[model samples]
Target: MILIALLALPALGALLAFLPGRTGRLAATCVAALTFGLSLRLYSTGPGFWYEFDRAWVPALKLRFHLGVDGISWPLIVLTTLLTLLCCLYSLWKTPDNRLIGLLLALQVGLLGVFVALDLVLFFVAFEVVLLPMYAIIAGWGGPKRRHAARKFVLYTLFGSMLLLIGVVLVVNQTGTADLAKPAGTATLAAFVFLALGFAVKAPLWPLHSWLPDAHSEAPTVGSVLLAGVLLKLGTYGLIRVAIPVAPTGAHKAAPVLAGLAVGAILIGGLICLAQTELKRLIAYSSVGHMGFVLLGIATMTATGLQAALIGNLAHGLITGLLFFLVGALKDRTHTGELAELGGLRESSPQLAGLLGFAALASLGLPGLAGFWGEAFAVIAAAQRGWWVAAALAAVGGAIAAAYLLRLLRKVTHGPSTLKLTGPAGYELAAWAPLVVGTVAVGLAPLLVTGVTGPAVDALVEAFTK
Candidate 1:
């Protein structure tokens, strides 16, 4: 019942968000907030899945409405709810059209469903649910190139979806069960390749990532936050949730290739960030690098590596979501995100500048922050797995991450006051403060996340070893 309600609330809110005036917006925000509280409460009711619900949805096809959560999906569920709540709060201050609010709530439905889904068909349905509303969000509410960016996003992800569907068919045909926990015979390498390519495009790894910067740069603030925060996680989450567990043989064979791509993204993404002059695009590219760390963690196929990947996913959601919010706030004030067009922001808006500085540090994997644990542990896991070369490459990528992020801080926040900017607004602070606390809290005490995700990773690793 809790699982069904958790999945249904946002969807119901989507229609309610269309109600007239501020009432609709308030309803939307309340729905998101309530969902967050519910998710947290569900997680807190001891460890493992709380709202266990399974029902036959498509008997002829062997599909069921299977829904549950373990350590792996629990934090991500919390993340999706938290980000949605924050995004709703941020939207309240600006008060976009009621329909946009509705779309956001609708988006939340898909995101929440994806995390808890225990069946592949269910996961795919939830996966595709996210596409339409996001497309509308970008195309309708984005920047000058919003239409182009939105279309590109659809094309790339849609193509990826086709591959994903193919992979799903192969897996289902071979296993005859949609339940993720029930092991199937070793999936063929082609099935794994199809799945990896499909997920990678959404993950936007390396070459497949070209659409992300444009999408991020053009999207509305709420759209960008959700995009970076949750949409991207779907891909990495799929890799962990589906690709590895179902296809261990294929995963083992492909580890080196995945590791290589991870390194490429780390190095290539950093270099690209160094060349980016626009703030949003630069941050978008940084995602490519940060997600690289997550891929590396999974490639190691060790408990520590999986733990690193899970924590990294949470940290990236917190840190990158904060960065996007700050950038959006900065852009709102300056009317531009060009590094040269904005300078000495700290002098004009100390709070914004200070938050930006802290977020930048977190993004760069500064020790004691949330970002450090994942990057540090991923490399350690890689080395322990005897992928020394990949480990060294990841280490180098971390140094470059620091360089690029610091350069961004120096250029945008530290110069002489070049623009007369309104100081941080109350709502802006209200929106950013949680992300700030999360980054620092997770950094200072990584155990907050690791403790919950560790057991799941161990079990996952054991499955892979078998």
Candidate 2:
């Protein structure tokens, strides 16, 4: 029932949002809040599947409506609900459109469903469920080039989806069952290749990442928040939950190439950010780099590497989510996101400047921050695999991250007041405060995440090794 409510509440809310007037908006917000509260009931102490619901869905195909939650997926589930709730809250003031709210709730259902799905067919259905709603959000409510950006997002992901569909069909044909709980049973390397390539596009790994910057730049504030915060996680999560486990030999064979491309994304993404003129574009590019680290961790195929990747996923979601929110606020106030035109933010809005600085520093993997552990451990995991060169270059990517993020701060926060701006509004603060508190809390005690993920990651590593 808890699992069902986690999806059903938002689904019902999405339907409610289509109704007229403030009543729809209020109901949606309340639904979001309730979903978050319901998500809390998912918590448990063990390193096993905490809650599961399974039923026959397609007898002919051997597909099931299977859902399960474990340490590995629980945090992401909570994060998805929390961010959706916050996005809904922000919409009350910023967007105020019933349709947009409906879209967000619909997106939440997809994201949560993706995390809990235990059958490959079920997972694919949830995975694809995320597409159109997000496309609509970006196209309907985004900036000047919303149409173009939305089109690109859909095209790229749809291409990935084609590959993913092929992979899913191949897996089911070979294994004779879609149950992820069972061994993949003689699935071939080609199946894994299709899956990896498909997920890579969504992960926007390096060469595949071009769609993201435009989408983020054009998406409205709440859209950007969810895009950075949780939508991207679907790819990385799919990699861990689906691709690697189902095709361990393929993953092992592909690790070197995967690691190489991930390093490229890290360095190349950082370099691009350094040259970016627009704030949102810079942040969007930064995701390519940040997710690079997570992919690197996964590529290592070590228990430590996998754990690092999980934490990296959560950290990026929190820190980058906050960055987008701040950037959106700046654009809303100054009527510009161009770095050159936006100066002396500190002079006009010291509080906002300070929060921006904090988010920037945290994003750059400052020691004692949430971002540090995953990056640091990823490097250590690479070294553990004796990939000294990869580790060294990845460290260089970290340095580049620091350089670009600090540059962003100097350009926006330190200059003499370019335009007078007010501090974040009450609702804006309400939306942002939890993220701020979460960043600090997670940074201070990574165990809040690591403790839960450790056993599950260890189990996953054991499976692939066998």
Candidate 3:
């Protein structure tokens, strides 16, 4: 029941928020908070274990209305719940229309479903559910190029979803079961490729990533947070949870290719970031580099590597979420992200400047921040596998990380506070503080994430090595 509540509450909230006036934003925010509480309560009742509810939906096909969360799922689940709560709160000051709030809640419900769903069909359905509202948000409310961005986003993602569906079909057909917990067969290379392409598009790996920057730049603040902070993880998560586990031999066969592409994305994304002026676009490219570390982790197929991937996901969410929020604020006041025209933000808004500095430093892989361990440890783990070349490439990625982030910070935070404003408002400060606190807390205490993820990685190592 708690599990159901975790999935259903947002949906109910979305439905009710359709009611006329009467604090629709407040109602939606309360629902998100309540949902987060429910998730915590569920986690507490369990002794660091998966809470699953499975019952036959079709005995003829072995599919079920299955849902569960292990250590791997829990971190992402916590991520989903936490980010959703933040999104709701953040929506308070910039509250759009009540319909928008309801729509955002709908997106949250679907994203939650995607993270915990166990059945392949359930996963796919949940995954697709996130598309419409997001597309609507982008197309309906985005910037000058919103329609194009939304179209690109929808087309690319749907194309990837098709590939993913093909992969699911092959796997289910081969294994006679869609349950994620069961051991996958070793004989499904073709199916694996189908799945990888689909997931990669979301991972937005290299060639498939064209849509992301445009989407992020155009979408509203809450949309960008969830998109960066959660939506993209859907790809990498599916890779680890479904693709690799279902076809180990195929995964091993593709490891080299995946590793190469991961390295390429890092370098290329870094170069692109250096050239980009649009605030959102720069952050979008950084995502390309960040997820490369995740792909490298998966490519190494080692326990430590996998841990790096999981932790990296958390770090990217925190760092990028903050980046988007700040970008949105800047856009609100100055009405432009063109670096050539914008200058001296620190003077204009010391609070935004200070927070941006911390997030930027954290993003550059400063030791104390959440961003450090995932890439650093991923390279270390990769070296142990004699994949030192890839490790070196990852090091280059880090250097590029420094290049782009420093460039962004210099422009956004330095100079002479180009756009002036009254200092941070109460609600604005309230909204911004959680993300700032999150970055610092995770940076200082990396284990809040790594501890939860380590066991899951160990399980993977044991499975693969055996």
Candidate 4:
């Protein structure tokens, strides 16, 4: 029931926000705040428990209100709550519309529900629920090309979701239960292929990532923040939550091809990032590379591999979220995201320069930060599994990461500082600083997240090992 409450607040708020006179923002913000409080309550209440609620809503079909949370998902839920609260507070002063807050809240509801819903039908519904509000947010409030971006985003996502639905139905009919805890080898390989394609599109792995740069480049600051910070995780999270556990034999069988695709995303995304001229689009491409690393971790089909993938997912969320926020701030101030059009910013806004530096370093996996462990673990896991070639390729990917990020930093924050722009405004700092500090803190004390997640990981591994 608590899980359901947490999931419904934002949706309810969205519906209510259409009223007159500041009602939407006020109500939505309060609802977001309450949702965050509820998320925290789940943690202080118990670190390693799943608060569950279920009642048959459709006895004829065996579907129910089934919802739950565990250590594996709890941190993500907390992270979701914290980021949403930050997004809300950040938007207080300058967020565009009363309805915008409602949309933000709606995105949060969909996101939190994605992490918690246990039934396949329920999960897919929540997963697709995210699409509309997001599409509306981008097209309604984003850059000049908002319509183009939104159309591309929706069309691609719809196609993927349809394929995902097909995969889920095929699996459910064969396996007899949507509970991912149940093993999933009964489905034909065709179903697994559809499922993998559905997810890979969202992960935007390699060739399927074409829509991302447009969405990121065109989205509003808050939209970009949520898109990168939380939304991108949905596909990967689905794979982890549903694909792997539910179809272990299939997942294992598909590991090599998946790993190959991951490596391709890494090298290709890295090369493309090296060539990007728009700051937001560049960040989007880097996500392609970063997600590639996460997939590589998952492909190892080992305990360490799964752990690396999980950590990578969380760290990528934090780092990319911060980066998108900074990009938005820059865009707001300079009225541009084209790299060549802008010169150095360090002299102009020392604060902006410094924050970008920190975020870039973290994104590149600077040691002792949130980004380091996931990449490091991936390399180690790959090597340990005798995927020495893939490990070497990942190392090369890291080097490529360094090249693009360092070059980007040099272009934007170093060399000239000639933009003469003002420093990060109070509100922008308010939104960005926490991300920087949190990224660093998580980097230094990775165990804070890893510790909470370990037991759950052990349980997941038991399926394959035991």
Candidate 5:
């Protein structure tokens, strides 16, 4: 019931957001706040599903209207809610378009649904539900190349979706049940491959990642935030929850390949960031590198690796979300994101410069920050699996990450003043403060995330071992 309400509130708000003027915006913000409140009820101690709801939806096909929450999913569900709420609140001042607010809320419903869905078919439906609103968000309100970026984003994802649908169909036909809780009886390697490739495209793993930079560079601020913050999580989450479990034999066989590609993404993404000249595009490329670390953790398929992946997922959501927000604010003020055209941020806006620096440091996986644990543990997990070469390369990737981020700071915040920009707005601070606090909090006590995910990760690893 709580889970239903958690999803329903945003859904209802989305409709209400079509209302006229401030009424719609206020309604959306209130609804978002309420939805965030509802999500809090999902938290619980220990492992396995803390709550579950299942019902038959299609007798003929064995599909069901099933939703469940567990240690592994609770944090993500909460993150989806929190980020949506913050994005909505940020929209109130920055965007103020009722229609945009509506689309954001609509996107929220799909994100929450994905985190809570327990049936593969339902998960796929929730997954696909996100496409149009996001496409609309990017196409309607984005930069000069909006249409091109949106079309590419949709085309790339649609191709991935086709593969995902085939994988889902294959799994369902073989097991005769779409319920993820049930064993995937004799599911083939081909099914896992289809799913992995589909998800990798969304994770926007290197090579398949071309669509991401364009999308992020052209997307509106809120759109970019959601894209980097939680939208990307769907892919990594799908890997953890579906691909590996449903096809363990394939997972074991393909682990090495996944690790290799992940390292490639880490190194390649960082190298690209080092060469990037646009602020938003640079941050966008950084996501490819960061998500690469998360994927590396997943490839190891050990308890340590999975736990690292989970925390890394949450940390990226916090740190990268903040980066996009800050970048958006800077762009809004300077009217440009070009690196050479922007300099001495501290001279014009010390507060914003300080925030950007903090975000940059956190992004670089600085010790005692939210970003540190996941990358460190991912390398450790790879070494644990005796993939020493992959670990060493991933470590180099980390150093490369630090180099690029510091370079970003030097280019944007340390030189002679290029533009006189106003400080961040009150509403902006209101929206950003939580993410800032969350990053620091998680950095200081990773247990806030890890404690919840540990048991669930252990259970999944146990099942995989069997």
Candidate 6:
């Protein structure tokens, strides 16, 4: 029931967000804050699921309204709620637009649903629910090219959704159950391939990732934050939770192919980032490289590798979300994200420049920062898994990341003052402080995340190896 409340509160807020005008925004903010409090309470309970809900939803088809959380999903649940609160805070500082707040709350509901859902049918439905609100966010609130980007996003995701539905139907039909615990091994090769392909679209792996840069470039700040933050995790999470565990043999067979694509993304994305002149687009490209490391981690199929993947997911969320927020803040002042037109930010807005530097350092995987553990662990996991070539290539990715990020710093934060940008606003600090703290905290103590995800990873690895 508490789990239901955790999922329902934001949805209810989305409905209540229609209250008059400004009241709607206030209502949404309060609801998000309450949800954040609930998430913290959940975290305090510590490292496992507390609530259980299972009852028949579609009796004829053997579906159930099942929902729960485990250590595997706990961090993501908290992260989702926290990001929603921050988005709301940022919205409150801006004009309290009714539609924006409403959409945000609705999106929060969809994200929470993904983390808690235990039935395949329910997961698919929850997954589809997220698509519309995000489409609206990008299309309605985005930049001049938003419509095209939004359409591209919709088309790509919709196609993936179709494949996902096919995979789900196949799994349920074959196993006669929608429960995630049941082995989806009957038609393992076909089912796993379909599921992995579907998710890879959302994961935006290598060749399938063309839509991401456009979407990020066009989306508004909060849209990009949640998109890069939690939404991207959905696909990778599915691979971990559903695709691999259910079809271990198939996953093993596909590992080499996945590893190849992961390496491609890392190298290609890094190279593209080097040539990019637009700030948001470069950040968007960097995600490809970052997610590449995550993919490499998963492809390794070892306990250490899985742990690295989970940590990388969480780290990417924090680091990229911060980067988007900082870039958005600068864009708000300068009206452009073009690198050539922006320089000497430290001269006029030292605080913003400093934050940007911090974000860049974390993004480049600077040791003693949040980003370090994931990439470092990824390389270590690859080496331990005996893919020496992958280990070498991944190391190269790290060097490229450093190169591109340092270039960004020298071009935008140092040098002669080019644009007179204002420092960050109060709302910006309020939103940024948590991400900053998370970055440093995770950097200093990787165990905060590893501790929670370890048991789950061990169990999965045990199951897979069997």
lDDT per model, in order? 0.89, 0.91, 0.83, 0.83, 0.92, 0.88
Clashing pairs in 4: 344-417, 369-443, 370-443
Using TM-score as the yardstick, the better of models 3 and 5 is: 5
lDDT of 4 by residue, 1-466 (tens): 6877888777787777666767666777778778888997876323334688777767788877678887778877877877777787677776747778778888888888889888888888888989998999999989999999999999999999989999999889988877653445466667777888898887778889999999999998889888888888888888777887777777878988888888888899999999999999999999999999999888887778778888888899888998988888888888988898776788888888888888999999999888889888988988998888999998899889999999999899866755667777787777777777788888888877777777777777776554
Candidate 6, poorest ten consecutive residues by summed lDDT? 42-51
Total clashes in model 4, counting residue pairs 3 or more apart in sequence or in different chains:
3
Poorly placed runs, candidate 6 (over 4 Å): 44-48, 182-187
Where does candidate 2 stray beyond 4 Å? none
Tens digits of lDDT, candidate 1, 147-239: 999999999999999999999888887767668755574777778889999999999898799999999999999899999999999999999
Clashing pairs in 6: none
- Cα error, residue 76 of model 5, in Å, equals 1.0
Model 4 global lDDT (CA atoms, 0 to 1): 0.83
Cα TM-score per model:
0.98, 0.99, 0.96, 0.96, 0.99, 0.98
Tens-digit per-residue lDDT, 1-466, candidate 5 = 7778888899999999988999989998899999988888778988788888888889787778899999888888888889889999999988899999999999999998888998999999999999999999999999999999999999999999999999999988876777777556367889999999999988888879999999999999999999999999999999999998888988889999999999999999999999999999999999999999999999999999999999999999999999999999999998999999999999989999999999999999998899999999999999999999999999999999999999999989998896788888899999999999999999999999999999999989888788
Candidate 2 vs candidate 3, TM-score winner = 2
- Poorest stretch of ten by lDDT in candidate 2: 177-186
lDDT score, candidate 3: 0.83
Shift in Å, residue 223, candidate 6: 0.6
Backbone clashes for every candidate come to 1, 0, 4, 3, 0, 0
Candidate 4: lDDT of 73? Answer: 83
lDDT of 6 at 179: 81
